[model samples]
Target: MIVLDYPYVSRFLTDSVLELGQAVLDTPQARRLAGDAPLHYIDEIEFSARLALGGKVYTNSENGLGHVLRCRCNEDLARQIDICKDKALFRESVAALHPDYRFRRVPFEDLAGLDAPDVDYPFIIKPTRGFFSLGVHVVNTPADWPAAVRAIEAERAALNAEYPEAVVSGGEFIIEQSIDGEEYAIDVYFDAEGNPVITNILHHTFLSADDVSDRLYYTSARIIETWLLPFTDYLRDVARECGFRDFVSHIEVRVTETGDIIPIEANPLRLAGWCVADITALAWGFNPYECYFKELRPDWDAILTENQGMATAMVIGDLPSSLDRTRIRDVDYEGFQSLFANILELRKIDYHQYPVFAFAFVSLPETELPALKQTVSQDFTRFVVTE
Candidate 1:
């Protein structure tokens, strides 16, 4: 069973759900978004009953988590969500895995009272329950704390009404020591026996050290080939540690200089939020959603042979923060797409309803990686025409 809710659902996901004959939980939002799409609707009662019978449930967005938590009959599943959603709790849960890791959880009201003099430099501070990169900031020095606090305050006020507490809570924040190395995001599920099944692996790239925006993510056969086996092993350990079974997660991790894999956080019961997982389909010719429902794994050797040296990317077209969205008249999507050599799909979002303008998927060769890097650094304000 799949539960669909805001902020965005890709056409690829909706079609895949229908193609796999998965029942979408009947909700007004689902109905409205999937108009005339012939989706199999399952009422709350039946869905809850299926949950009691250990039926697997996958949610596309964390916004759908509230509904799933209310309807779910499995306490274990709820527990898993609790651990993954709360960044502080997630850190504590996995602390045994990395005993040397340092972290502290602070209440939202107590943020101002935090003593910067005693604090360690080069740490990350973010809402305990956060989605995307909202409220995430890196404090590299004592001087950065005041600015970070101010940013968090602004974010607290701006985001409180924008998302559900289940999605982005402002009640508490976590301060953790930064992990060094290359970051990657994975879409994987723990099967009935608790074995990890990795469906997609994306290298989360950033232009600079302080750039925490979710502007770009891409995947290629080379990325999968290098990290698949090690990540699978690490996730296996994580699943066992967390007591996870028949659960899906979008996990972020940093592979250290010494080749140690340290988890950042695990987003439970979904692939990458906002259908970024579709890059798997665009790159490897398989549906990520269907892979979980049907228990299918791609033959990596064969897939790599077919998709050598190709990179598929998901670029977020975020509106410039300084631009007044309320006064926006038009978005130059054509000019934006002109930046890319080959766009596989462009999913334009309603900027009036959401902060982003679109989610673009592009296909690139390994030699063209510089283009992806260059695209992320582009100023999005140039694409907006405000009244």
Candidate 2:
């Protein structure tokens, strides 16, 4: 039984989410992630749209979140790839791939003491199982640890309120000396034959030098075409080195000034929600979801043969919760359009009161990119809400 994690689906790009559901319909022996023998919800609109699109409704039920692998992957493969979810394990696994790729990790328990000291300036502390950048902090100096820990404590409480089922254990964390550089993410797909394909490389935007909150990410088809082949080849090596096969993953990396790619975080079975994977569709013609099941293994030869041009997907980060827990009350809309004129679609996922992420998809010519990046970061509320 396939069980689409819910209320969870409500948290993503609905267009791409529906495309994913359609892929399930295309896959043989697949069913919705929420049914029990022909009765399951398709969230917002499985009944109407399914009927309109001539989609099938499968009601076979599956219980327990542990069965998530049954939704689209084999059990062994899922477990193998999931280890990367633990940020600590992820660092070891990636560093194992090559000595040059290095990340220092320390348990949070080690830092809880008052006397143990002298950590370098500009370090990061994040939950071992963090999501959406919650409980992530930057320690700019020795004096910042107290406030940083307090912030993590507050974030832990807010996260517990948002997701009670999966609590963040305070015992473990990966504290790393921060690295400098522009950050990026690569969406990976393995063909049914185990060949890894780098479908998209996202250019990320941050609020400031110490800002760990994930703000914006964008990628274009034309940009992907210009990337060096060795980068993808290196990713394939990382996959093989880590013992992952036949999987979909979003690998986060930092590109240093010298242009070396450094892999930092790994999320298995697709990019983090909000349909970041849909950028693949915005980049190439097919959304990553449709490509995954409909093709099972993507047909890169045919896709590249089409020689698609410029297109981009933008994912804007949610406003960070205030210390007082305030809601967003304002947005700079005119500033947004003026800064990024190529926006095709722009909207907030949740209202200012609810405070979720916002996104846009567009295709801007190369000439405007430098200004786009600088202006967007400088004007924080231009496209997103501010608390």
Q: Find the candidate with the highest TM-score and give its number.
A: 1
lDDT of each: 0.88, 0.56
Cα lDDT tens digits, model 1, 1-387, are: 989888878788889888988999999988877778889999999999998888888988898898778965889899999999998888888888998888898998998888773546798998999988888889999888888898888878776566788899888989988887999999998898889999999999988988888898989889999999999999998888888888999999999999999999999899999878888888899888888988888788998999899999989999756667899899999998888989999988999777899888999998898867987798987898889
Q: Can you tell me which runs of candidate 1 are displaced by over 4 Å?
A: 117-119
Candidate 1 achieves a global lDDT of: 0.88
Clashing residue pairs in candidate 1 (N, C-alpha, C atoms within 3 angstroms): none
Name the weakest run of 10 consecutive residues (lDDT summed) in model 2: 56-65
Question: Lowest-scoring 10 consecutive residues by lDDT in candidate 1?
Answer: 112-121
> What are the RMSD figures for all models against the true structure?
1.2, 7.2
**Predicted candidate 2 versus true structure: per-residue lDDT over 266-381, tens digit per residue:** 77665545455655665666655555444444566676656554546474635546512254555555555555667766655543333454566666765566666665565344
